[model samples]
Target: MNYFFVINARKFKQYLFIALAIIFSAAIVYSEQSNVSVFMNSEPSAIYSVQTEKKVIALTFDISWGDTRAEPILKILKDNDVKDATFFLSSPWSKSHPDIVSHIKSYGFEIGSHGNKFDNYSDLSDEEIRNEISTAHGILTELIGKEPNLIRLPNGDFDKRVLRIADDLGYSVIQWDTDSQDWLNKGVDTLVNRVVSKAHPGDIVLLHASDSSQQTHEALPDIIQQLRAKGYQFVSVSELIKQTQVETTPVEDQAMKQIH
Candidate 1:
């Protein structure tokens, strides 16, 4: 009887261990399904840095709610003869500024989704996250006649879930390599200095186009001139991604192109 009891106890422990292992594996799979998908080989990765022999970089702007600087900034780019940059436009922002969205495309600028609302993706349910991406994508396509294949999560907030949803929705999630920090209370001189000091070949620099982004606006021409002085040429986010040899198109672009 003693031996039988010991054997039973050992079997019980074994069963418990197996149960725990299953639970752990389930947790991992759940986590992956809940968040953004990961690329094992980094073949379809976003541009976090550039790899060109010459000095070149991409400048990107996030337009969430405000549009005070949108037209003027666009003019600035035109005056500077800047051909390319990426603008991540939120859904509501596009809804309110359809003409501006059109202008962005008409001027040959690349558009990227900034989600449906200006809310943080970190606070959204998985379904909500997918909805946000899809909604913004639809709105942008309807307005500009092209679905954005790139995205910069609102407030730059992202996680595995966010990435997975973006990937599933067919976007290459983009992040900045150089932050101008022009949205902060930094003085114009300091802001320019920070960017200039951090500027490098093949960098993706982040800026903003809201009312509070005046410092960024002020620093733009100077940054351009200085980077030019250093022999750097500006390119769009998509171009920069291509330069690095990473795939930038989301799966959605192909499908939408087919439909159109």
Candidate 2:
């Protein structure tokens, strides 16, 4: 009487298997939805540095406006036999000093765009941002005979909108992991120390080839020497990025990955 209706063992197992399959399928669907949400709401990012274990670094110079500073830096690089560097050249500066730009090209260093103006792209209207990058691209392409696809925004400043606009214009926005702070006109020792102390694998070291960075040329030799001693090999920004894996998370949404 207690088990008037006997249950078949095979039927019970089949039912249990069906229920578990449904739950697993539901979990998968929920997970996919969560991923979609994160992707949709996340902000854009620039390539600040890459992830790699190789002893490689990228030395980048930004020349926004200057005639006096770039040549000395180029000379030091040449004298030191450091050919793997990148210079982000602004349109105005490139126009006024085409000869210096030509020298940079002749030295076999890489060239990237520093945009058309020294103003912050984050503060510009979307249309203005596009114009600045495109105009610089046009000028540099004419001057260098090929379009520079890499850019470092004026002052390394950008927001989500600026990043999106740059990407639309076919630019890979480059930023720095190790800032030399040479623009402060700090002493040669300070500039050298800042860069050498923080240098690491896959680092993009920021040095300036503008008039404001009075001591960068002075410090370049030592920076190169110390980094080389540490077994770091210099490469252009493109080469550095190519050899390493990259992560592109916005500054604000960096914590989004911690959520379930």
Candidate 3:
């Protein structure tokens, strides 16, 4: 009779359930945090910038639409003695201007893929994105004789799927940390200032080499000078990637060994 009066089975069950729920929620939170830390630390393919103390910056030009400024841009880069500036080329532009393609390589510039055409890849499916990248990859490989390990999506538009497909195809998706806003037809001074102010160590600066950006050529010289003045060394995208070397087997190029 005494023992029967003391026990409340239902109450005990409710307390146990609440305790389990608290533990489970805490476990989920911890798991998510751990995943985030890993992703931040180890994602080698899709990199915006490397975390480094050295003042190294990459200047990139997208040359997808027109070739009018191609030689001019190359001349500007040469005049600045800027080596390893990356040029991402669209399939149509690359195919149509074979001489310019040769010029880019001959001038010792790094060539990258700008997709098959100027396509906004934000909404494309994996297969479609793969097709776009693969076609461009094939073309650029043929043109440059080096399978491009890097790609810059058209219009700077990309989704998670775009990055996944790019990785599967042995390409790192490149996005710039410093955009010149030259595409917006901003004036030369404004464009130069945008890059100079936003640039930092391990930054990838975006400028256009196509006729679409009317003032990039004018702005580039100043941008280069100011960046050098600020003590930032200009590097190609490949050289920039070397800072965070996590060795990856990029899909297409067995001949060209790459460190991620």
Candidate 4:
């Protein structure tokens, strides 16, 4: 019996050692895989918002196809003395309405590219994306007499490849954290609440000056008033980017992400 007991103890010790060795090997393999994943998933840079505590926000308007809506928005900005706004103008629209483009430029508002085609860049070929951005850049530069360094993809659609191409062309892709959804023309109250409630430091507010948005011009006054009452000051998108220490993360499609 004593001899059998000794044999059983020896077997138990051996099995325990094998189990610990297997666990250690698995841990090492997991650590290596994690390191590889971190390197492989590095994301390109895009400015959605900044990392700052200041009460600053950027009121950005996208004008893709419109002549009527922009003027009212411009007037509202001027009346409110809100000088730090950004307008991303599509090349085609700017070509058709040079006078309005001039008015926007006259206000000293920072102009950016809204891309030439109103299509999802993530769905386009890499070469096609490059052409769209470059074409828009040339047209806007001629109209504004200054090169546009910022861009907001049409429909706010983009992927990592699109970001890489834009970066190569000397553009910083600007995305918004707050969306007024005025394009829906839901109501002046809904638009106002969407913006005022979501307003935060270093926020980029997406509003449209395109004709599709019927209520943005009307909502602008209340939006500005409420934000100011909350202690948020408006800045140009470029200024907002400049004010923060930029950080990028690996996200699939976050251009249209809304702050909830």
Highest lDDT against the true fold, candidate: 4
Taken over the whole model, the C-alpha lDDT of each candidate is: 0.78, 0.85, 0.80, 0.88
Worst 10 residues of 2 by lDDT: 251-260
The number of the candidate with the highest TM-score is 2
lDDT of 3 by residue, 1-260 (tens): 66664566667888999999999999999999999788655553455676677899989988877768888889999999988789988988999999999999999989999889566766667788889999998888998998899888887676556766787788888877777778888698898888999998888888888888898888888998998998989989889888864332222212121210
Q: Please give the RMSD of candidate 4 to the true structure.
A: 4.6
Pairs of residues at least 3 apart in sequence or in different chains that clash in candidate 1: 35-161, 36-160, 36-161, 36-163, 36-164, 37-164, 170-250, 170-251
Candidate 4 Cα errors over 4 Å, as ranges: 1-42, 247-249, 253-260
| Model 4 C-alpha lDDT per residue in residues 141-188, reported as the tens digit of each score | 999998999998888787888988998899988888778888988999
Query: lDDT-based ranking, best first?
Result: 4, 2, 3, 1
Between candidates 1 and 4, name the one with more favorable lDDT.
4
* Pairs with steric clashes in candidate 4: none
- Tell me how far the alpha carbon of residue 170 in candidate 1 is from the true structure, in angstroms, after superposition: 0.6
Cα TM-score of candidate 2: 0.85
Residue 120 displacement in candidate 2 (angstroms): 1.5
How close to the true structure is residue 257 of candidate 4, measured as C-alpha lDDT?
33
Error of 3 at 169 (Å): 0.7
Model 4 TM-score (2 dp): 0.82
Candidate 1 vs candidate 2: the TM-score winner is 2
